[model samples]
Target: MALDHSLVGVASDPVERTWRAGDVIVYALGVGAGAADPTEELAFTTENTAGVELRVLPTFAVLAAQARTGRRLGDFDPARLVHAEQAFELHAPLPVDGRVQVVSTVTGIADKGSGALVSTENTATDAETGKLLVTSRSGVFIRGEGGFGRSGPASDDWRLPERAPDEQVRYRTRPEQALLYRLSGDRNPLHSDPAFAARGGFDRPILHGLCTYGFTGRALLHALCSSDSGGSDPDRFDAMSGRFTKPVLPGQELVVSIWGDGDGAALFRTATDDGTVVIDRGRVRFH
Candidate 1:
């Protein structure tokens, strides 16, 4: 099937969602927020466990905008869509809980000989105040589908530093990690049912890409935005982008290398302890 190139540049109707502090905590836990140390990360996993309002992880913007992904893209079979890359630019820190309005657009689509890449951008604003909160961009790789007759738009291409990583953060994923992550609105059986995973040509369930995205962000927050560790502030985190290179099996150890850009932000690359690069060409830009 070919994508409808005509749909490019079209914006979808806004989707309004009401999220609460409890919802934020669930998403935080789904991504392993407090696993490093519950007390140290209580601000993320609890509303006021530390007497401060919880801070939403930047990656949750993807989840908040997911409902609108179906609007702009034309009738491509859901079976063929595969997530390729994702990015989020935060204009302001996400409130602990509030009404959010999400409007998405099909920024572009690229035709490949065998398949097509569909790119989308979703912008979210605070519903009550009309303040822009986040703008998220993502690309989907459709297999066995192409011939859309368009080359899409130019994507952002930035350079990482040429030196060694400045720091590394390590974390271990639980065997039931995927199970917990799926509760965060991604209920695909491929992530929960072993029989379904085997049928799909995997030995067991795989971790959600967004789950890994959150984990990567959590690692960054710890290494660069925490007190007494990297001597960084959470408010400094402004944006993050990454390309998924490999699937992560639950129960594997993830080690992420943090390279500072000499700016407030940094570049990141994550891999399993076995040296398999799971997230590549990753970057986080903060002010």
Candidate 2:
């Protein structure tokens, strides 16, 4: 069946979620924290390391806000769904352990000929203090489920600058990267199970798009938001958004290029060593 356009604008009931310091550490490692050297990102990879205190990555907001919507878009093969875009804004730096009440809404369903783009927005608030915490927006493209004849939402006016990027950082993914990242609650077979991946037109399992996002987020966090002491400061990171243009296999290296866009923001993109852009139209706002 095709997607249910009626689902648009429907809001889900509040779902509460809680995360511990351990969860944060696992997520950090999932995204390649300290993979190069355990001692480098001690703040994120370990909760206790002498004078260094543990800190949560800004991208952790995406994982923290993932609560069951208790609603389905429509009937279709799960493999047909692909993460198309993702963005999140942090109202405040996330704590190592905290409880949150999350409300999600199907904000839009646009027709894109071959498939439909279903967009969602999630708002998470501190359960005890009732203060806003994170707002995340994401879109998924469902192949073979479009042509409903409805025009989708307008695209953002984003264009790359003509000048060279101010900075570029590269990180290599381990061959077992997907295996580790899946532990962070996204158990989709697309990132594992070779047979399942083959069915989705992949030679082998591909890394999760969000995993790539997390990797890119790590590059941005350090390049633009690091503390005076050279530690990653989540407080200095405000928001980020990006579009996934290609899949990344495990063990491939990722190069993140950032251009200062002025006004405490920057435009960035992630590519492989061969210069194939995988994540494009990226933007990040920081202190």
Per-model lDDT: 0.79, 0.92
- TM-score for every candidate vs. truth? 0.89, 0.98
Error of 2 at 123 (Å): 0.5
Q: Which ranges of candidate 2 are over 4 A from the true structure?
A: none
lDDT of 2 by residue, 1-287 (tens): 55777888978899999999999999999999998888889999998789989899999999888998778899998888889999999998899998999999999888898888899999999999999999999999999988778877678899989989899999999999999999999999999999988877899999999999999999999898867777778889999999999999999999999999988999999999989899999999999
Those runs of model 1 whose alpha carbons end farther than 4 Å from true positions after fitting are 69-79, 153-162, 195-200, 227-232
Q: Write the per-residue lDDT of candidate 1 for residues 141-223, one digit (tens) a residue.
A: 87667765667656567666688889998888888999888877788776888887776556887888888888998888777
Candidate achieving the largest TM-score: 2
TM-score (C-alpha, index-matched) for candidate 1 = 0.89
